[model samples]
Target: MSIPQKLFSEFLGTALLLAIVIGSGIMGERLAGANEAIALVVNTLSTIGGLYILIEVFGPISGAHFNPVVSAVMAYRGLLPRASLPAYVVAQLAGAVVGAWIAHAMFDVSILQLSMKVRSGTGQWFAEVVATAGLLLVILRAPAARVAAMVAAYIGSAYFFTASTSFANPAAAVGRMFTESFAGIAPASVPGFVGAQLVGAALAVAISSVFAGAPVATEIEPKPNV
Candidate 1:
């Protein structure tokens, strides 16, 4: 797509993705009573559905990279221009804040709040590393036709398996930090989560490069503007 169109798609896609995540968490927490597991299940399912749709809708435009780390990896692999990385990151981060605000508005909560939920420690950080690595691996390996489903499935599965609920996307972490809902992560914890995610992304790229050769065209589908 054209640069403007690509950036717009990324912005909109990431906004919707964060809205789904935070909104679902708020809804689930309100309805699940004291059952944290039930709340998580609802959140996971909704996120999976939303993720699938967003990827499908935007993949043809900006390759649907709603995460800064993913965009960085793509640039490193030569699938994206290095000069485009800053725009992608800026769009994703801005979209994340907007998405969190929208979620709060939908839930009738204060828009001016920072998460107080403290998520840290070696185990949680390790989980982020593993979660992010697996996410990138799946994206790298998925066929063009299956990228949407595979990515959604992996995130859904990671939610249950990973201690940090698989906040594999850096933009997602930024969005969640702005809220005080069940999905929110304390602002203090964001740096750690984001750092771990970046390390994991780098590791995934290294391993994939060793085994999978150079990047493939499946990274994105053919688009007229692109």
Candidate 2:
């Protein structure tokens, strides 16, 4: 796929992600007695299901990296083209903002209320770090380990088990700020979370950097048939 088209697919996937994440959160709130944790897990699972489908749909085209961290790690593994970074990030973030707005409109929430996090602070930050690191680890290690679906499943399960809740795409972090919702992160906290995810991604890269020059293609050239 062309660069613009790939980025456009990423954007649509991200927009869909926020809509599902936040929209499900709102649904869970009403059904489960405003149980924030329950709501988050429900929404997280919804995202996992959505991403599983999205990965299949867009993975062949753009690598379906809705998260900047995922894209960065792919670059680190020498799987992605460098020039695609800026456009990919921009598209992902813009889509997230649009998604957040759509969720708020559907749920009738205000920005301040939307940005109000049910979870935050130091512990949450640690959770964010670990969760993101784990997610990137899964993605990077998946194909080689022959466990792609397992990795995606790991992400969903971790979000359910981890305190951080969102394990948000770094780009999605920027986009989610436009509205106040269960899935939205506060604008004040975006910088810290974004930094954490990037750091986590970098750390993942370092951990696997020893294999930096490892051969990626498994296909071998055929010798002369003669």
Candidate 3:
């Protein structure tokens, strides 16, 4: 694919991902009333479905990496050109913010609001580390054909298991910071979450190197322009 096509793919995929996450959270919260658990279930189910579809649709175009950590890992492993890393990260981050705005527009909420939801502390941070690490592990090790399903499934599971509800993606953390909705994480909390996520990503790289042997070639690998 051409550079423009690749960037657009990444931007659109990441934007839609945030839209699914934030939009579903809003819808779920409104429909579930005071039942937070029910709301969470709804959010998780929507995310799982949306994430799967996005990966399948965009993987062939841009590797469907909506997260900076994933992009960085791919760059590190030479799956993606190191020279392209900055552009990829910028695209993803911009997409995330736009996605949050899109969700707000859909729900008729304030588009410029900042998240006030506090997500902090040692347990939550630790959970983020674990959540991010596990996510990278799955991405690195899962077969190409099964990656989309496996990733969605892992995220759904991590939603309940992790204390921070598994905001494992730094782009996601940044995006959610823009929303005051159910899925939102306060700006104050973002740095810690991002830091923990980076740690988790590094850990995953180390662990996968030992256990997964060489990186498994996948359908998501970027193809050269014809």
lDDT of 1 by residue, 19-49 (tens): 9999999999999988999999999999999
What are the C-alpha RMSDs, in order, of all predicted structures? Answer: 5.8, 5.3, 6.2
Candidate 2 clashing pairs, residues 3+ apart or interchain: 114-180, 114-181, 115-180
Candidate 2 structure, TM-score to reference: 0.83
Candidate 2 achieves a global lDDT of 0.73
Q: What's each prediction's clash count?
A: 2, 3, 0
Which digits, one per residue and each the tens of the lDDT, describe model 2 over residues 147-218?
Answer: 346656877887766667646468777766665656667778888788777777777777667655554433
C-alpha lDDT score of every prediction, in listed order: 0.93, 0.73, 0.96
Q: Which candidate has the top score in TM-score?
A: 3
**CA-RMSD of model 1:** 5.8
**Candidate 1 ranges with C-alpha deviation above 4 Å:** 214-226
Lowest lDDT block of 10, candidate 2: 212-221
Across 87-154, the per-residue lDDT of candidate 3 in tens digits comes to 99999999999999999999999999899999999999999999999999999999989999999999
TM-score-superior candidate, 2 or 3: 3
TM-score of decoy 1: 0.93
Candidate 3 least-lDDT 10 residues: 212-221
How much is the lDDT of residue 21 in candidate 2?
A: 76
